[model samples]
Target: MATNNIKLISPDSKLLQYTQIELKDPTDAYLESCFAAIQQNRYTIESNTLVQIGQTNKKS
Candidate 1:
């Protein structure tokens, strides 16, 4: 069996997510992509949240 590496690209072509799928069977992968697209914005928001948390911890 072969595998395909796919990256969920953002509107600006940034990499929002990544996954490996079986080349011969990608149905589940497609469904996952749909969910990923909906949650893509969360990725950036989460990243910012982490940075803010880190800074707050450092100050405490």
Candidate 2:
């Protein structure tokens, strides 16, 4: 498994946070698709996991 650290910043640019995501050798295309899905509200982070809306299984 590989871990990636993503920096979360506030809209005001005053606050910053970091989250670690684990994946199995994730590729750039996979990351980009995840970002797009998140922006579209198709996926969300819950309990340190990425879950697709309308689905019961978590995406790793």
Candidate 3:
């Protein structure tokens, strides 16, 4: 079987709220549940500042 890595990030209360939510057990009991859970998390990336910086700055 092939495996891939993934990452998740969040702040405190949001993290705690996320932790409290329950997931249904997989019928196949696949080990991929870990990856699925991580993929299911909600995230917000701050793209505004990053877009401005990249546009305003140029590399030499």
Candidate 4:
């Protein structure tokens, strides 16, 4: 199975949300739900590292 990697970016190309979806439970609605939850008060992913699980520059 393949994994789905998604990164939501802000208007400034900042990372607002990051997600990893497995084949078992990956859906557009699920993804959209995850995105909508943080539509407001979002932050850009100023910086991230490979070691980190996700990236969300909520303070950029």
Worst 10 residues of 4 by lDDT: 43-52
Ranking by TM-score: 2, 4, 1, 3
Candidate 1, residues 1-60, lDDT tens digits: the string is 222344547677755455645434576665455445545542223533421222233554
Better of 1 and 4 by TM-score: 4
Scanning candidate 2 in windows of ten residues, the lowest lDDT window is 14-23
For model 3, what is the alpha-carbon lDDT of residue 22?
36
Candidate 2 per-residue lDDT, tens place, 1-60, comes to 222454547677833343435444558557656666776779877786889988577889
lDDT of 3: 0.33
Clashing pairs in 2: none
Q: Runs in model 1 with CA error above 4 Å?
A: 1-24, 41-60
Instruction: Give lDDT tens digits, candidate 3, residues 1-60.
Output: 212222224443333222222334563234344334434542232442211112245689
Highest lDDT model number: 2
Candidate 1 clash pair list: none
Tell me how far the alpha carbon of residue 12 in candidate 1 is from the true structure, in angstroms, after superposition.
34
RMSD of each: 9.7, 9.8, 12.0, 9.5
**Whole-structure CA lDDT of model 1:** 0.45
Better of 2 and 4 by lDDT: 2
